[model samples]
Target: MKIVEKKNFKYVDYLWDEAKAATLEGNEVDLLLYRSNLLGTDLRITNYGGGNTSCRTVEKDPLTGEETGIMWIKGSGGDIGSLTRSGLAGLYVDKLRALKKVYRGIEHEDEMVALFNHCIYDLDSKAPSIDTPLHGLLPFKHIDHLHPDALIAVAAAKDSRKVTREIWGDSMGWVPWQRPGFDLGLQIEKCLAENPGIRGIVLGSHGLFTWGDTAYECYINSLEVIEMASEYIEKKIAGNGGVVFGGEKIKSLEPGKRKSQAAAIAPLLRGLCSSEKRMIGHFTDADRVLQYINSNDLERLAPMGTSCPDHFLRTKIQPLILPLEAGADLSDTTKLLGKLEPAFEQYRAEYREYYESCKHDNSPAIRDSNPVVILWPGVGMFTFAKNKQTARVASEFYVNAINVMRGAEAISEYTSLPRQEAFDIEYWLLEEAKLQRMPKEKPLSRKVALVTGATGGIGKAIADKLVEEGANVVLTDLDAELLKEAEGTYGKDEVSAVVCNVTGAADVEGAFRQACLGFGGVDIIVHSAGLAISKPLEETTEKDWQLLQDVLVKGQFLLAQSGVDIMRKQGLGGDIVSIASKNGLVAGPNNVGYGTAKAAQQHMTRLLAAELGPDKIRVNTVNPDGVIVGSKIWEGAWAEGRARAYGITVEELPAHYAKRNLLHEIIRPEDIANGVYALLGILDKSTGNTINVDGGMANAFVR
Candidate 1:
């Protein structure tokens, strides 16, 4: 929210003019390059990555004047600092525009899985930016989107709309946040259908988005809208403005001094940059710059974090809050590094805790997080990279966030992201796909897996983990949450979680229909979902036996039945992970329905492996006895069931089970996920096989 300092404002306007002029001259490449650089400058005065700028070029058909209209989209993976023209992919404009016109359909579960794959393009990097088409929808050649901290402060607030409405009036349109891509594009197209010549859009609970016939016009419109918003809010607060003053009337350092400083700083870092050293400029004293230095509550006043989600390519997460106290020393660079080291540690720890709680595998360890870069207070930010490209990308984001923070305090506050959603986006499939496309260390990418009771716990884990390994996964469970969560991870494209009462004949038929839609056919289905109940012979009810039969017997037959059909169609073989207890292999006292059902489930798996050998699906079961964490088979259920047979307390159970396993290690859900991946990827050709994901418990089953 801080007003641009008169001096700094001039610098900003200068860069803006230079960028706009380039675009006005019909230099698309220069337009993009200029905006990218100006945007970097603007970001330094705000919070990290507080905003982004994009340009849409209308490429035409070779023979016709009509628009072939291919859009060279900013490929999703690269940061703007080092964003390369080569990374831009030509999107078929007609197809995307047509997609924008369609209404959202009530899609089938498996159908959604198929659709997610279709979203990819020949660029074959990560999925295209969900907003690529949205940007293309704008007729303007240039678009500027900002999460100006000041604007968001007033905007993200409950009454932000009133403030924005008061400021923007009929000048801009507003849209609510929806799932990005087709649905969102449809909504935007609907709105634009009515207001064809609109200039900008202010997304509710999001940020300011501006557009123009040219890049300069776009940048100016954005500045005008933001300035008006800032002025309106400043007056509404009943103050002329936050009164502030200049720095130590430090004699206007000569232009010669500016050149010397810019020269010194550029060379110090240029050796680390990728490509050749390009343009270099330095900011001298500016009015907003002074306001930024003198602004009160520097800590809380800064933009919350990012100006926009896309801004991550520029300003990272947070900025180094420089102390502008009178007589303060700006030369003490080490002090800035000292304050950051601890905060970085805390950030990594929180990140680790989040990873462990969500990651299905305990097998693959956490990555190093020493700090992507450092924020040096008065000196601005510096990136840490063995190479210049990454270091500069880090620096670009660092500055953008700072500028966003600078603007944010004026309006009120700009929200970054909610904690959980941040984690989801931070690890989103579109984000993860970049890693997936890279040559993997192991040859597991093409594996296909079938996981049962995949709607929850062990089954879901096995299913999702398989997808990360570059495998297509089929998950079966009666719960819809499995699909919801899985879709949240794999975008409903690479992973399918179906609701099937595995006990029913018709339902199993439906599950295979889903698999066909998911990956064209089936390769693996882990019969991981089943149930357990405990009671002595007299206490056990007939209802328990009936329920158990539906799952352990009938359900197995139906699921195996459908899978065989798909495997036959596929002709290529697959793997099946059946989760059975140690009691099924041998016997545990008082174990009635579960022991019998698992015994039946295993025999059926072997039976299918035998029957389907000609079609090529390998059927197997991971007989894990006591892997309690993250499986549908809850410890309480296992405890009560085990105690019924042994007459022991539930509290004494983990210990009791540990006594039976040879390795004395608890079977984690990750261990089960590992087993699922292993079974699918292993070269073993044998069918009707069993892998004991259990840590040596099968050896202890002497009976």
Candidate 2:
């Protein structure tokens, strides 16, 4: 981690400009956007995907069987920040253009992916970029590409043409931003034909697309255009005079708790490239405090995500508001989704209608407009995707995207492309296939995770998430009805549910045996079922302590040993995630047996990590605070009574625990679920540690 001086910043900036400028010097031009095309290939622009860059090369040589010219682009999985010459892959430009013309008789994405995968590249370092075809349609040699907020703001707005007319006027052309791929190339070609001598193009609701005769020209044009839009927005917004009055205060959520919340949110924000680290803002200022507490403006302002296109991919339209009764804290998964899923439907219906009215031709429906991302109150935005990579990417883009939109909207109304126009780009045939053809990795897909007490609150959610990732899952619980309900929830054959008393060694062993028989071999295990009995030392019984131990400590040991045995046989280290609780760290008023059992659970979690480290198995514990509020535990008035007896409202209880830390977020089942997922090699880094699931609880320190 290093910081460059403000003065030094210009040089790095100039270097990218120079690189883009240098490309056009030898009749070889790299788009100026390639210079600093995207922030990085992390959780920013393209998820775990690489951003693209290219130059037009004349393959019109008379040597052998020379055919057509090509668009050389950044290969798959390469980052845009440090793009080298070898990073770009070459594709026949004419062939790419041909893809769009045959609209009715177009190829599905899978076929095209297969075709490109076979295309010869200079080397492995250069794989085909996802946007190669889109680049081919633009005649300019140096084109700069980026999903800049300044540009996206204009794109997502309703009157892109009107907005551009007010700014650059005749100097630029406003094309409704479409999804990136071949269809967009065709659209660009058609639009270009309509207007000659256009150097810059604004894709509504997406980003800015600009090209120039030279890299410097292209770079200058991009900077000028972005600054113009951003400057205009700044000027207008300053006049609006944002929310005023004294800034509200927020309680702190601690470092360990902050990390847990980030982990909890990581899975949902898969497509958006964001790090789980942003959950550390336990102590923010007035604006954050206001936005944190009151989400009334979310629908009118940040609804369905950014007003424009790419933001839709990341933020997914809007944030789920925290219910009033939630007491400014969210602890249950159901309350979060109970509020989340309905709004999603409202947007989905509109989506279906948008496609129905202006469907140009039969395109195999746009990727399940199922809304890829979600933002929750208390918890930061959660981008939903099948994998961690997708979620992180979505979250990163969304944070900045949302911030920029909020700022820009303050100045003027946000506008964007009409529904039909947005659809064409989203379902672009060429881009769709390019992604499908990517080589698959075996480290994750096909791996199995057996989660104990998985039919319960936290365990059930974790099992569901893993199944979403295409993992083989074995769901076990002592409650047959709960497990049966879980079987219904997950769909038949996707997961196997077995009734087992984990405290009984044979029952635990039998469940493992059954899972092995069902899914071949197991690679990950999560021990989550436990008892939390809160009573005074005076009222405590020997049976109470024993009951807690039988369920919490004993269950975790038996499950981990079984997972270890199965993993060893498969010649791979397995992952073991134990769901501990906040009581483990901080003692509450009368939770004697519960607190002791939880503390013991944490020790066992660490001991397993140390023992399994030698065998390559990674073990970690997820200690969540205030999660019972959203679980069946709360439905039965257990959490409510617990909160009442403690002299606090149930709403205040989660925050009492959360405000004790740095990030003031309540622990949710999904948060605990996400932490377990991280330990299971979803991140593929670090080993042997206990990660908290509290939203920044201050003193529950574990190292």
lDDT of 1 by residue, 1-703 (tens): 1113323332234355543454446656456656555554554223333344566566655556566555544555543434456644455555655553343562321123224334333344334555565665655567665655445545454455565666777666667644345555456666666666666666654566777766666656766666666555556444525432212233223444432332233222212221122111112233343344344443453434553454442333444332232333323434533543455556556657766665543223444433343332232333443222334445554444444444443445445554444444455555455546755333444344566777667776776677776665666667687566665666433565667787777777666655543333455667776778866668778898889878777776777776665454333555665777666787656767767888887788788788777766777777777766665566566567666566678666667767767878777777877776676776567678776766686553423
Superposed Cα deviation of residue 140, candidate 1 (Å): 14
Off by over 4 Å in 2: 1-52, 58-70, 75-79, 82-87, 92-134, 177-187, 190-196, 242-296, 302-309, 314-319, 322-372, 415-703
Minimal lDDT window, size 10, model 2: 276-285
What are the TM-scores, per candidate, against the unseen true structure? 0.42, 0.50
Error of 2 at 386 (Å): 3.4
Superposition TM-score, candidate 1 onto the true structure: 0.42
lDDT of 2: 0.59
- By TM-score, the best candidate is 2
Candidate 1 backbone overlaps, count: 53
